[model samples]
Target: MTRRLLASYLSLVLLALLALELPLGYVYARGELNRFTGAVDRDAVMLAELAEEIIDAHSTDMLPGLAADYAHRSGGRVVIVDRKGAVLADSGASAARGRNLSQEPDIASALRDRSATGTRRDAGTGAEEYYATMPAWSGTSVHGALRLSHPLGPVQRRVHEVWLALAIGGACVLAAAALTALALTRWITRPVHALERAAAQLADGRLAPAPVIDDGPPELRRLAATFTRTATRLHHLLQTQRSFASEASHQLKTPLTALRLRLENFEPYLDPRAHDSLDEAIGEVERLDRMIHGLLALARLENSATTPEPVDLDAVVADRAATWAPFAAEQQVHIAVAGQPAGPAVAVPGAVEQIIDNLLANALRAAPPGTSITLARRRTEHAAELHVIDQGHGMSATERERAFDRFWRAPGTHSDGSGLGLPIVRRLARAGGGDVTLQEAPGGGIDAVVRLQPAAPAEDRFHAGRPRAVARFAAHPARAPRTAGATAGARVPGGSDVRT
Candidate 1:
């Protein structure tokens, strides 16, 4: 954009400069030519007056000395002819001294009492000349005519000088205009480039503030200001969305918990066939509840800008492996971290931990009991990376592509697990300026790479991940604690807490 604007400005400057110089230069050249022609006419008039005086002094015969002097002073060819068209005095062209002048239009016109002046090419030299002829009269009776003509060489030379000057002046003006245009273009374009970079950051969810640019044209300044306002508004709206989702999720948990508890209490009273039917009903409710929980977590992660702090990546992997060990044992799978916790783990809080837990649970359900699930974390240049790899029947490319979509699961996979696990991991990673991706694991397993922002150098404090327990706490009416002692064997019918 900057380059294009600069080019346009330069083009306009060149055009404007040409418009100002072209006509003025031509006019200057024409004025010089006019002045040269005026000089020729004035000399002709002066010579005619001189001829009258010479005739009045009683000299009709040729006056060689006076004629020579007139020719020298006029810088022209002088010819004096009588009333009978007999040449009287010839200055330079003396061969036709007695030649009749009646044949010449200018001379004939002068004989009729009108002055004649014009310019034409001289046949002798092939050069343009200005000529003026006036009547030589004695007491109102025209005796002859005096003609004076001069070549226009001096006038042409003056016009040529003007032309040269105009050429040089135009060149200088255009050069100066180009330089000025470049300077102005930079002034206008620099700020716009800055704004473009800021807009990109905003698009990428960086939420960076727009830069303050107090320079450039008035209109550009206004545009910069408008961009800043738009970025601010978008940031605010995103925050509001996150807040709304969290609030709604918190509010819905209470009823879901109470309803599950009531359903579980009634399960023992039903017959075996009825019990089996009741289990299916409970499973569907559990799926719905898991989906809502996933949504709430996704919203929270998307709205957060919190950076990772110092925590042991290996420890995180190991701890998650240990916590999911029971589920792995149930599936007859070996869940392990590839390496010991070597350094301070990146502090990813509860959001990231839950994402990992969900991914592990899904892998355990899909893979055979003997499958091996490995979790590992390593430091990277920009962040700490976590991997959850499972040696199970891996999904196809299409399945992997849609794996992170909310409520999306493979057709053959267990219907009991909600499809929100991978998406929740992705949201958390993105919120921390990181990302999550699924790939074919080494030797035909599923590999999930999760990244989180690097911790600050000095910080060791890690914000605890959102607690699974607190997340389950109900604010809805149905989930309030019952007064009587609860049965030890009674379990929440749907362990999942879903918020729509």
Candidate 2:
């Protein structure tokens, strides 16, 4: 932007210089030529008067001296001729004293009682000369012609110098204008740059990213102030949400746990018929607990600003697949990890695992006995993808579109399911500059895909190949596998493109 602005400014300066200077130089040169010719003509007239007086006296003794003195003062060649064009005295060349100059064009015109003044090329020397011829007349009787010639070399040099000076002046002006334009462009674009940085930080879940830039134009200053205010409000809202989630964690969990434990303690005192009802109640409590956990996780994801870091995609896929393999075997189902190995992907901390865990758990719920669930990792030019493909009857297009809405469950979903899974998955992916989408598998199932922002070829990792991570399944019998990600084609309304 600065370069473009500077170029535009300099271009206008050059055009103005050309428009003004070309005509100015031309007029000055023409005026200088006119003045030179006028001065030469005046000198010619004066010498003609001197020649008239000298010729009228019929004594040519002082004619040569007078012409010589005039020529020495003016740096010109002077000559005196009679009415017949006979050279009476020559100031420059004594050899031309007796020469007849009647045939010369300027001398002929002067002998005819006329004045001639203009430029001509010298026959003897290869140079341009300016000649002024004046006739010597006394009351209608012409005695001779007084002619003066000056070399055009010095005047031409002066004109050339004028042009060179104009060129130098224009260049200096352009340079000054460039410097001024650069400074102005920086001033104009400063707020824009600040806004761009703030937007990036906000996208990364940061609060107020930077201080407002208030030194630009009025419009930009206003925009910066508005943006700062908006960011501040957004930050406050996120902080408030974080506080609520944190407080609700203690308040909501303890009561639900105590209530469930008390309900279970009554199981031993009840009859077998009432025991079934009690079991249902306990199951409801567990489902509520899972829902609360999902809600709190989502709150945390939304409220915290987490920078993306590199994680080995292949290692993550392998570890999670191995962990779920035993669980799939228990249900007489298989977990298959396939597809080409990809480079590391960038995501927020624990985002990949949480997304995969939710998707895999959902896939397991829909998988039939003896069927296989595939975790396929693929790589595009700029991003990696992990597709949790399950062999189940997926939702329709309408349901898929609405799947990303908070707590939006499809028709006929199990009572144990929490609908916040897909929303959490999407937030996690987007935090790392990636996205999630539901695609229909080739075999009538849902291919739940989370696109990954590819990390650098050689990156300093956040948690590269760390085993038994926090989200890893240990003592799995006490905890039911979560359905955090929408494995069965819960998609955003818009379609996606293959970004390379």
In terms of lDDT, the best-performing candidate is 2
Clashes of 1: 13
lDDT by residue for model 2 (300-363), tens: 7666677778888788788878877876776677889989997789887767777777777667
Whose TM-score is greatest here?
2
List clash counts for every candidate, in order.
13, 2
Could you give me the TM-score of model 2 versus the true structure?
A: 0.75
At residue 99, what lDDT does model 2 achieve?
A: 91
Candidates in order: C-alpha RMSD to true structure: 12.1, 6.7
Residue by residue across 1-500, what tens digits does model 1's lDDT show? 76777678777867876787678777887887777767767876776777777767768664445566877876788878767667777777767777887888999988887889898888778998888888888678887788888888887887787778877887787778778877887898888888989987886668765789999888989999998998899888987896788677867777876777888888888887898677666666655566676666666555555554465455556566776676456547788777434354443454555556656755654556577888876776676777888887787888888887767768765445456666666665665467888899978868887777666557655336523322321211111011123222232222222111
Global local distance difference test of model 2: 0.78
